[model samples]
Target: MVIVCCSILIISCIAVVSSGMKVSLEVDRPWLRVHLSQRAALECCYRTGAASLRTTWFVHNQPANGTAVPVPVRASDQVSSGYRMRGGVTCGTLTFAEVKVADSGLYRCWFNDAGVFTPGTYLQVYEPLKKTINLSEKTKDNILMAEGFLLLLCVLVPSATLLCKSKQLHALEQKKATREEENIYQGLDLNDCDKAMSLYQDLVANEQEEIQLENP
Candidate 1:
């Protein structure tokens, strides 16, 4: 009889502890994927009133091999390394302003007073893919041809201008030299004509004196 009574007491104690440890929290979104630098949220709802229980959040960063360590999330209105807590009585939200790859983890919500925790949500943060512009072969060829034409114009235009200017300068120099040569030849011809006139006048005066002497 004493053993039977002890068994009943143990059974009653087990029931009481089980009732106290009953889970009342429900977490939303079993899994989530978000790009880096985007906003992400984890929500927890409870059947019990807010007056009876307080909600808390914890995160476990996924590791490469071993088990992850859980870290408590701090509540704040400003941007923090942790998360911001929002919402009213029935539901609580943990919000990240900008999520990073390091923010990828398992998140759990707990009711400290009720001793209840919701099944965790896994968040995967990924880098966004880079954008690329696709061009057709025809378009690429057109662009290349246009660039080549512009480059050729850039080289040929200046070269043509320099060649024309050099030709003009050479023509001007030749014209000036021709004018100088013509002026020098005209001066030499004028001096030679004056000398011929003086020599002829002296030869005529000597011939007239010889004829007069022979006649006398």
Candidate 2:
């Protein structure tokens, strides 16, 4: 009787497994190949399965190879050894929000039955672009990075030109100011020399007048 029951159980497991699902991950295909920073969704779906079906979504593959993932009522699940919780199994679908590049992976979704429930789905996650990404945006970083390298040119180009122009203009102004100061000092010295010479000449004239008066 036990042998018969075991055989029946095995056969029933096979039958459940044979009722396989046509599964796929769903997202806008064009955005799949992009490199970006903003968030997007790596929407998991059993595209051909009916809503009446019950399933479970998992992060890392469970031991015993294909155990059903426990659906969390809250936004969290007991974090697996290497998996951080970012997605939830809703109905029969898995949804990850604020999708980053790290979110890319095979997400195994299985029907709640005993056998390794058909085939699981794989999700290729990615980050979304804030704006349209293009060659210009890619090159912009390199251009901005290279700006640091050309800093000598940036500073010297305009500064040297301005310095050259101002140097010439201020050269004449500085020279004129220096010349005026020297001229003022020289004039003062010359006036003092002239006054001394005139005083010496007056003394000689007075002495000669005395000599002439004595001789006459």
lDDT per residue (tens digit) for residues 76-168 in model 1:
652233223235336667788888788888887666666555556788999967769889999999999999999999999999999999999
The superposed Cα distance between candidate 1 and the true structure at residue 131, in angstroms, equals: 7.4
TM-score of 2: 0.28
lDDT of candidates 1 onward, in order: 0.71, 0.49
State the lDDT at 118 in candidate 1: 58
The prediction achieving the highest TM-score against the true structure is 1
Name the regions of candidate 2 deviating beyond 4 angstroms: 1-51, 60-74, 77-91, 114-118, 125-216
lDDT of 2 by residue, 1-216 (tens): 345434534554475557664333223122233243433333323333433345455443234666634333224332221122233322243444344454444454444543323233344455554666556876998988798779968888999999999999999999999999998887777678899999999999999999999994
Please give the RMSD of candidate 1 to the true structure.
18.9
